[model samples]
Target: MSIFLIFALSKINYARTLIYIFHLATIPAIFAGAALTATSIGITGKVLAEIGKLSAKEGQIIIGAAVLDDILGIIVLAVVASLVKTGEVQISKVIYLVISSSAFVVGAILIGRFLSPFYVQLVNSMKTRGQLLLVSLIFAFILAYIAQVIQLEAILGSFAAGLVLAETEKRSELAEQVFPIADLFVPIFFVCVGAKTDLSVLNPAIPSNREGLVLAAFLIVVAILGKVVTGLAVFSKEKLNRLAIGVGMIPRGEVGLVFAGVGAASGALSPATDAAIIMMVISTTFIAPPLLRLVFKEPTGSPQSVSSEQ
Candidate 1:
């Protein structure tokens, strides 16, 4: 929804500029779309844990879909970033990226499933006791490198590596070993995202920044709508609470900020546009969690009333 809305809004606001120089308009629009691509599983996961619903069916669906959503987001980013550099949205390129990224993810899981036994055997044969952990990290990095080599996002490779690792019997042990490393690094990443954001651009006192503030406000509405609409995608396999699931998917959090930061660094997002994107991220992050908790509390409430509470 953000992608479609931002692209439509961009055309309205920047169509003349786009006509004169397509790259100028499209890159920023791409940034807007990219910013909305991924959800922060951390936020959703914490909410689920807090509600004691982590083991519930809705939780399982949300968590599972979120991983796939992240993968798809990376693929979208790769395709859009490629378009920015090339200054054209080539269908062939998009198709290739879609196929390659999907194949990479699916292939990794299928191949990993078969090779997991051999991997276990190999790990046992190694003389080093801690080699399993080292191997897993190396594997993720190697996949990241390979992804870069293939003109895809490195996250694609790393995520695939993770999927592969997940199939192994040692996944729980590996996760335990890696949890500390994640705790160490994740904060630094968010810090960098904050550092890159020019808060001045969000200041309403500045006449020039007001436009971005307006855009941010508009983006916020669609961002919420985009995630909320995902509830409709739920299969009717059981009497599931779709509102709670959709609300669970609402927070963009760190992942959106990360995308915005990267776009700024790459020059795809102008300062004003970057500020708008950041605000969009912040709005969703702040709004989604509390609203999610509320909707979950009253799952049978009308959508109108549920949304009004937010």
Candidate 2:
């Protein structure tokens, strides 16, 4: 889907207008398309909980798929960030990135798994306040620093740390401790992105800005259709709420914003292109939750019958 979006959006003249005007290159278009591939597990999970489907099979599937999507998206972001830094695409570098990224994630999980029992034991033995939280943060930061040293995204390492620690007995407690940290830092991150973004490109009153508006509209359509079609991939003898699954995957949320932020910061994206990507993210994030609720609200069969059929 990411590849298709990159190719398809790049080929469209409207989508490339801002890119041609500012960057005189296709990388911004690529960023725009790549940004579309992100699905926010945070938003999706919340919606699933709201609709009383978080524990349901479809909900579980979407959540798991979103996690995979995020991991892959982070890898893609790393590759794109590298491309921006080097200003060229080298197949050898790309291959190396792919291999190293996979290895970093897999290696981290394996090593962390082996060490997790000790990790749990150490935390349990600590009588100091906030010991578990501090240890977890230290572990995550170490992995994140290692990722940076290895030229991969730090978020990937943090995410890998999360996966490993989630298997431990303190998963719930760790999550509780992390919530306040996320609440504090996440908003600051968004605020920084907003401060850096040139919102003037989105103004329709300006003639040139109209192109960006058009580009944003195009992206919004592609973003919606791109994710909605993913629902059809579920192949099973028993019926499932495939539409719900797809809709659940549609919100780009903070993940999409991260792509846009990286693109803008790297100077790979023009103001118009960056604005368009941001608009696409905002549109998808807002649109998906209600659509998901509506889709799941539809009559597909009783839960009992569906379970029996499964």
TM-scores vs. true structure, each candidate: 0.84, 0.86
lDDT of 1 by residue, 1-310 (tens): 4323433343234323432433347567766766665678989888777766667788887787677667666666666665566666678987887788778778888988998898888877889878888888888999889888888777778878998998899899899999999999989988888787888887999898877777777678767876677665565669988888778887888878867866787677888788888888888888877887777778655564444332
Which portions of model 2 miss their true places by more than 4 Å?
Answer: 1-24, 301-310
lDDT, candidate 2, 88-143, per-residue tens: 86889878987888788889889988998999999999999999999999999998
User: What is the C-alpha local distance difference test score of each model?
Assistant: 0.74, 0.80
Worst 10-residue lDDT window for candidate 2 reads 2-11
Report, for all candidates in order, the number of backbone clashes: 0, 0
Over 4 Å off, model 1? 1-24, 233-237, 300-310
Which candidate number has the best lDDT?
2
